[model samples]
Target: MTDTSTDRFDFALLQSSNERTERRNRRLLSWLLGLVLLAAASIVALVLYLQTFEREEAERQRVADGQWLERMVRFHLRRLEEDLLALAYHARERQTRQGSVTDLPAPDPLRGGTLYHQPDVLLQHGWVPWDSSAAPMAKALRADAALDPENAAALAVMQDTARGLRRPSYAGPLLDAQGQRTDRLWLSVPLFERGLFVGTYVASLSLDQALKAAVPAWFMQNHRLERVDDQVVWANDETPSPRPRDGSYYAQLELPGTQIALYVDALKTRTPWLPRLFFGVALLFLLGMLGAVLALWRDIVKRQRVERELQAQVALRQAMENAVTTGLRAWDMEGRLLYVNPSFCRLVGYSAQELVGRSAPLPYWPANQSDELELVHRELMAQGTEAQGVEVQFQHRNGYLIDVLVHEAPLRNAEGEALGWMSSVLDISERKRAERLAQQQQEQLESLGRLVVVGEVASTLAHELNQPLGALSGFANGLLNRLQGGRIGLDEMPPVVDRMAKLADKAGRIIQRVNAFARRREMTREPLELRSYLLRVLKPTQRERQVRWQWDLGRIEAWVDADPGLLEHAVRNVSSNAVEWAMRATQGSDRAPTVRVALVRSPQQQSVAEVGISVGDSGPGVSDAQREHIFSAFHSGKEGGMGMGLAICRSVIEAHHGRIEVGIDPVLGGACFILWLPLVAPVTT
Candidate 1:
């Protein structure tokens, strides 16, 4: 009976212990499953976060690409406008003296070169006269079909607008000569003569070809540029798209006469998903045994990566701030310096600690300029807007003034409230010194030019007056000899006296001309008859020397606007130079001293109704080595020469808006100097 009771009690105790142990095992299994589920959820969340980051990066790249495309479009448009302006300048320089636009010549560079005659992009380019009834001034340099009726009408409108506006105008995306669809752009630049509108210079360009020529090759590798319109498609790569979709950007630009939309498509880029995939696989492989440990390790690694990224960004910012040459600073409204970059401290010859947090009456401000700078600073602070760039001087730590251009903008907080002032300081001391040096050099050159003129006039005056004075003395002596010997009648005496009076008059005129030239007065141009002007220049030389003179003029009846005194000086200098050289040659050889003066017209293309004055000598011809430096100041080929004769002549001719060139005379077999002057209309008043 005792054994049965003990076994029952022990069985009950064993059953209760089993029940407790089973419950504890079930709870442990449930907790393990829950932890595994939580680890899976965390992994999923990390993957989603990575995907979001990639999407944001792609969007940022797209925005950057859009801005780049806009800049490219603007750059191309500016280039086109510049090319058009260059063409217009060429036309203006080559216009006719009569200001007639009936028949215009092409620029010298375009006459034979295929670049302008038949450019790949240009269909036609020529001038259109003011007369609406007349055809284009010149035939198309490039081969193309005749203009269609629609194109002609478009050209008419452009011409009229250019005439009315007195400026350049644009037209067309019209059909080509074949009447096929094409992107043809027509531009017209007005031709003006003395501020009078004369005609239009027309040009036709292929838009497709232009784009191909202008777009850079490197840009094409990463992005496909396309032209978008309502109905048509054009692209720099020649492959067109109806519209751009994902990973693409669009930029709109307004050209001379039309609007264009540019679409840039980004090339495909591989995303870095393999690393994320590998991480997930590793996490799953370690889940059961080291899940908790791996989770803690992952959190530590992520935190480290984030901190390293922040460190890298900070390093980049510091490098950027140090790399900039422009000094940067920040200040509060009360004029306390809040921050100073390394560049700013270096600029003022101070350390960051010495400058930052410094208040008004700052150490760098010069004592004498302190009040002025204070006033300017006060004005800038009171304006309540970003200040324009203001140039100011600062006293460096070395006690010397440093020129700096300061630009200030308002620094704003996250809520857009003005927090302080941000300043950019650029050291412009070198630039300012250069400008002052340039100004001083210019003034010196002007003074030197005046001195050169005075010296030339003085030398010429002495040389010129000697001839008339000697002639007069000889005439008076001869007359006295005849009168004392009673060998001449009253009639002969009258002729001798008249000759003596003329010599005196010639001497007086020489003095007057020299005085006029020496004064360096403003040039006064008047209509001068070409033939009479040449005769006056010949008179002085004829009286001085015994060289045979030959006149080779052809229908010379034109008038040119000239400073009469200076023109006479130039002609006299060149003719006398020829006479002197010719006489020198005659001393050693059998060749008779001869100087030929010719008046003729320049070539039609080279000058429009411009007259040429040629003075040739029968002397040793100029060598090629001497031709280049002959016209330069203080350069001479002759021994004992001051070398200012040709220089002075050039200055005179250029003052009259003409040009002079020296070369070997083909006709006379000697050195020749030709002066070309535009023939002006006779002054009515």
Candidate 2:
């Protein structure tokens, strides 16, 4: 009985020891897994964080850059405005001193020393006409009608208002609508010669050369800069898109020039602030994930291993062994190889006997990649923890490059002195090759697709040419007949002349349209009034269309960034679609089909700004099936649709960093497509 009791005690001690050993193994594994997970999550988050930061930084730079431009432009403009006001003040002073216009001309002399030469710009444009009296000479101006025929228009906008007991005289840039290249835009209070308002002294600057100088790198993208006369002044940055309908941004500058738009981007946007915040948060998340993973591993391993004996679980041990098929080698605190697996010897092409006791330092990977690798290694050594997953090429015994994915970890003694690194390698040559091939194919396909679309357009355009040719032939024949017949005298046959002229004009326009369609020309940008442009783009198309069009024509005009040809095409396409759909929906109904076009404007900017356009149709809205694939190339809904139009539309809009969206128009009860653009200034000048 005493012997049996002793055996039971012995068994109890053995079981407890077994549990302790199992617990130690479990804790080690749990900690290892926790560390791995933490490292992985942290790394992924870091990459995302950096990317987010880059975008946010870019956005911030844009806003900052814009502010710099604004300040520079504003300063120049304000200086001009102040100078004009000073001139007016001088006129008022002279009036008070002399008591009348006739006396003031010579007697008062405005008290302000007579002005010198005309501004340099007037001289540059070859129109500086100063007189012996040190004022603009009327004879000199009339002698050169080229100087300014629109002086009346420029002077018309002057308003003299009381500013704190002082008369505030002011006038600004006036765009003469009648003349394309001829306009005047500066005025001071007129100096009366004798009781009547005499000729006002004006300062003017030609935008012709100034505009060309304003062109910058970004401005050169997706546009062509043109003068107001539709003359292509400069053309580059034309491959992807046409420039703004006109390269014009709006702001009434107190400058020597008429209020004309100067510059505009194809799309308008508000400053973005989220990317920075996102990057920062992602970085924090990476750190947090690392901590959580470490904790989770500790908790799981502690619970499983410390509470039970696991040595007897032969299956678990065997599973671990099978999972690690590569060669393994472990070093002790003294840097001596404690164990070397058979697999390890095979990998190195060296026997264990020869490797053992020999200090075989691992080779530095891909000599070209050494600098980068060393940076990572230095960080790892300093932290005593590693961030892995860098790729490297290893020189094998066969003297060939082994494409590898590398991983590493630190080895430490109980005292925590760093010993060395344990590492694993994976051959990924096949993966790398596959990725390269895929990338090449993707690029090739994109090029092919673009070419195919161009070819198809060419074919379709040929068919459309026939109708225009017939119209031109008939118009030409009629014009010839009218000119030959004495019954249609040039002086007496007004009605016939008008009829033939209209027909001839129609034929010319058709030819122009065909000519434009035949080639992919760059967009021509010029200053354009946003409100006026919308009206012009809509009025004729809507009137000619079968759809009943609705719109809210606002009074405010904005100068927007756009390419005229591209704008015409995009707007025409959208309007055409809306009209077509609206007509189809109301085919048998008594109500006329309606297409609603709206110009959305924001009042935040002093100039008409933050403008957008929306085109909607009273028809069956897009189905769920269509919405998902709407922007996909060669994807379409209508039976005869080629599907390139919307795809091209999206590409063009995105190129300008603008978006096009389709949704149900709550007001119209049908599908609505929206286009947003920034309105900087108007092109009126």
Candidate 3:
């Protein structure tokens, strides 16, 4: 009985131990299954989060790209509008000058040059008269317009709008009869004459060609650009691809005085599966949490670095702005000053605090010039920019005026919207002062040169007066001797007195000629026939010298307006020099001393004709080296010459709006002098 009881106890104890082992096993399996389920749920959640992040990132990138493309398209379109406006301006100028619009030459921008790069983009461009007259070119353009009636109507509306607004206007991405968009667009720039609508400058553009021209290749690599309607449907001929609907970006391209809606579809890209696969295989949550922390830390570090770089850039820009010498100023459209740089403050002799936010008639504006400055400010606000800067005087704080050159340009934003005007002010007081000094110096030098000319001509004047005075003295002495000796009768007294009177008149005329040349006084000019004038001037020279005289005058009847006394002096000087040189050349040779005089008329195209007075002498020819300074003041080649003969002749001729030149005479084989005077209307009978 004791043995059987012990066996029962052992069996019961072994069963109890097995039951505990099975319970522990079931608990362990339950915990293992729960852990596996939790890991799977975490991985699924991470994948969903990554997909959402990727979609968000792609959408953001698309938006940014679309904005950039829209800006680029608008920029090019603005450039096109500017080119068209320039053409219109030129056409208006032509019409104003030529009184017709059809006379315009072929448009340069239409010629497929680098100015927009894409060839054959401009289909047609011409000036369309408001009257719709039957001009051949205008008629052909109208016929082309009639080919597409709907587009023509749209273009006409755009033109009317442009005329009313006095600005450029854009019309369709044209449509076909089936209501589908065609590859054509229109632009019109209005023409106005004295505020009257006269015509419009029209242009036809190929939409596809313009797109190809304006959109860059790099941007097209990742995007397909398309014109979209109100419903975001493609309006172009290109068929849509099966891209993700979520990856599209839309923007409105606001051009100058117009708007175009555009959309870009991001190209389909294969989803990368490698990272997802790696994340699944390396499924330890601790590793993922550590990676997240590391990524956050790196992102913080990157942001800090970027912030430091941005700060550095800002500091650099500030330093550059401060270092520049050209003063910078900004104004709003209302003429209110917005900003003034340090240089501008220094230039105006006022601090930035004193100038900023002030409008026209501000502190730096001269009190006397306020009205003019205000007017200029209004004009700048109206005209935006004047390429040839404005030169104005600004008063300094110390009551001195400063001359400043201000170059204005329209201030615009990234959207090409004009804000106001930005001006670059340059202090030109020193330069202006230097220019004034140079002008004064030039005037002083001119005065000194005139005085020197007078000094040089004094000797010639004395010599001229000596002969006439000596003749008068001889006549007076003879008359006195005759009267004192009682050998003169009353009848003989008349001849002697008449001779004395003529001598005195000659002396008076000589003195008058000298005074006229020396003072350079305003001349009293009259019509003088060249043939008669030449004859009169040469008679005395011929009488004084025994040289042979050849005359080529008496046929040409050219007339010149001239002061008789001054003209006679110039002619006499030239003839006298010719006679003297001819006599000298014949001294050692058997050749006869000869002087030739001629008058010829030279006609000019669309200008007053000139009359030439040529005097040739049989003397040694002028050398090339002597030609340069031959007419300069105090320059002479003869012994005992005052050197003012030719110089005085040149000055007198130039004062009469004529010129004198010297050259070798082809016929005489000697020096020749020619005086060119403007031919005038013939004297009436």
Candidate 4:
């Protein structure tokens, strides 16, 4: 019985030992499982944090891009407005010189062709001259549009609106009314002189074409530009829209003089889903391995790997920050500098060590404006709103003022509390210089235009006065010869002396008129019969040159309203040019230079009794190319020619509410210039 008891006790002890071992094993497995779960949770949290950081970064980038795009759009639009304003300014100056809006001549078509022609985005451009008649406007010029009957009504409507408003106005797409579909938008700029509405300058544009030509090609590579109404005007990838997706930002543009809601979309680089997938798979793999002995140390190994990855990410970010050219700096709420990038140091011409931790009243502030800059900084700190941008002058280490456009935002911790201000500084010194240069150039151009007009008058005065002086010298010499030779009888002496006095008087009048014109003195209008004026103008030219003059002044005598001095100058200059050219063509030939002047009432518009003075010469006809720019200031075809004759003639005709046209004379078989004049004052509606 004792031996049996001993065997049972031994078996019980063995069983108890087996139970303890099993319990220890189960507890160890539970501990390992907990460790694996903890590591997996930590990794998941890290991935989520990384993803959040990336998303925030992308959002910030998108906002910056959108703002930049908006600024660019505004800049270009403003530039276009400036062009229109410049044109208006030119028109005003012309009106002021001519003394009336109706007298303001059309600009030379070739002068500003680039402003509305090829290599530009204009679909069409024109001028509607102001009048008070039923139309209240007359078409002066048109480009890039066919003069089809269907388009007449639409054009008339546009002009009527401009005249009615007497201010800047925008019309239509101009497609439906014209029975055609096109992306044409019209803009009209009303011109006023001395508070009177005088005219309108109309321009048409294809919006998409214009925008595509303006945006930088590089910028479009990663972004898409579109209107707010879901029309994709331009895009790099030809994406119609990026709706219902992440990382898309919008910028609103309030275009001037229009109710268009313009918006631009900036697409961000998408975060790859592959990384998230890999991370998830890694976490699952780690969880599956937790039942083995290797997983115990894997928890520790995974922690080390996470730390290494974080360090790598930080290093990568630092590298990226340094690679960019944009200057970046941070300041604490107390206005102490917290950090600065390499670019910022380079921009200020200072070292990062010197700038970081520096506060207001620090180095690099311009001595004269240090207080002002400090005040601005204080104001910025006091305000919680983000700064869009501020143009500030910062003194470089070399002591020159640096023009910097600074954009600032609040730099906060993950809790969203403001820590300090972060700034991106853009060096816009070159752009500022360009703007100044452009302004100066514009002023110079205006001054140059006035000078050109003055120069033309001065040149013509010198040439025209010489003729009368030469005649006076000849007559005086002839009378002296007759008296000295003792061959002048009493009758001959009286006639010769009379002729000499008349020549002297003619010389005096020429000098007086030229002086008045050159000095820009005002003169009064005088009524003179056409026959008398033509005879007076031709007398001097006939005696001064060997050219033959023919007159076809019809019996019907008409009186003209004109400044006698100005009128005489215009007719004489043109006739003199015609005679000179005719002489050149007839050189070494028996034929003498022939200049024919004819006056007649317009047959087509005789109801108004419109009159025309047609001057024809037997000279080489003007070429098509020359005909276009013959009236342009400083354009000359003759040796030692001032090239101001035709230009002056044009100005004079326009001043009288008339127009001059050039064509081949059917009778003379040479150049013919016809000056058309209204017989009465322009009727007002």
Q: Output the worst ten-in-a-row residue range by lDDT, candidate 3.
A: 8-17
> Candidate 3: lDDT over CA atoms?
0.76
Q: Estimate, for each residue in 1-685, the C-alpha lDDT of model 1 and write its tens digit.
A: 3567655322222221235545665575567666767777777777787788778777787778768767765676455544555666666555544354545565555233222333466766655555543535334412222457766665567667778877666666666677765677776777777888766667777766666655566666777777765456677767766666766777675554555567777676436566567656757654643565555456655555555566666776788899898999988888788998888888889998988888877889999999998898886666533445888899899999999998888888999998888889999999999999999999999899888777777766656676689889999898889889999999778888998999998788778766765675677787888887898768868877888888887664878989887788789889989998999888967778999998878777864678989999998878998888998756777786767678778878887788999888877789999998998876554
The alpha-carbon lDDT assigned to residue 29 of candidate 4 equals 65
lDDT leader = 3
What TM-score does candidate 4 reach? 0.31
lDDT of 3 by residue, 1-685 (tens): 3567655323222221245545665575566556656777777877887788667666777788888887777777777776776776776666667776556566554433323455678777667767857544466445545667866776667766888898888777666666666666777777777888887777778867777778777667767776764343553347754432655676787533334676687765435466566566657664565565556556655655565566666666688789999999999888888998898888778998888788877998899899999888888788855677889888888899999898889999999999998999999999999999999999999999988767766766766676678878998998899889999899888887887888788778877877867776789999998887777767876887899898888665888999988888888888888888888988978899999888866665637678889899999868999899888766788887767778778888998899998998878988999999998889988
Off by over 4 Å in 3: 1-320, 332-334, 351-353, 368-388, 409-421, 436-451, 486-529, 536-548, 554-565, 581-594, 600-611, 618-640, 654-671, 677-685
TM-scores, one per candidate: 0.37, 0.33, 0.45, 0.31
Report the Cα RMSD per candidate.
Answer: 41.2, 44.5, 36.6, 47.1
Residues 536-582, model 4: lDDT tens digits: 87897889778888889988667777787777777877788788889
Off by over 4 Å in 1: 1-311, 319-326, 330-342, 345-392, 397-399, 405-465, 472-563, 577-596, 600-611, 617-671, 676-685
TM-score between model 2 and native: 0.33
- How many Å off is the CA of 313 in candidate 4? 58
Off by over 4 Å in 4: 1-454, 477-497, 535-550, 555-559, 587-593, 600-609, 681-685
**Candidate 2 — number of clashing residue pairs?**
24
Clashes by residue pair, model 4: 132-685
Q: Rank the candidates by lDDT, best first.
A: 3, 1, 4, 2
lDDT of each: 0.74, 0.54, 0.76, 0.69
| Model 2, CA-based lDDT | 0.54
- Report the candidate with higher TM-score, 3 versus 4: 3
Q: Write the per-residue lDDT of candidate 2 for residues 1-685, one digit (tens) a residue.
A: 3557555322223233456656776677677667667766766776677677666665565445444444554554444445544554465567566654434453222222112122332321111111223333333333333434454433433422222213223333333445444423333334443554433444454443233334344644532333222222222222223443532432233333233333334343433446646655766665676676667667756645544334334444455544665655555444455555565555555677866765424442456666776675554344433365556665555555666665656677799887865556566667888989999999899788767756645533443344445655775677678778744556755665565666566445544543454354454556667567777877877666766668865776656666665566567667777887888888888978888887765567445346677888898878878889987756767676766567656655554445688888777787888776665644444
The number of clashing residue pairs in each candidate reads 0, 24, 0, 1
Better of 3 and 4 by lDDT: 3
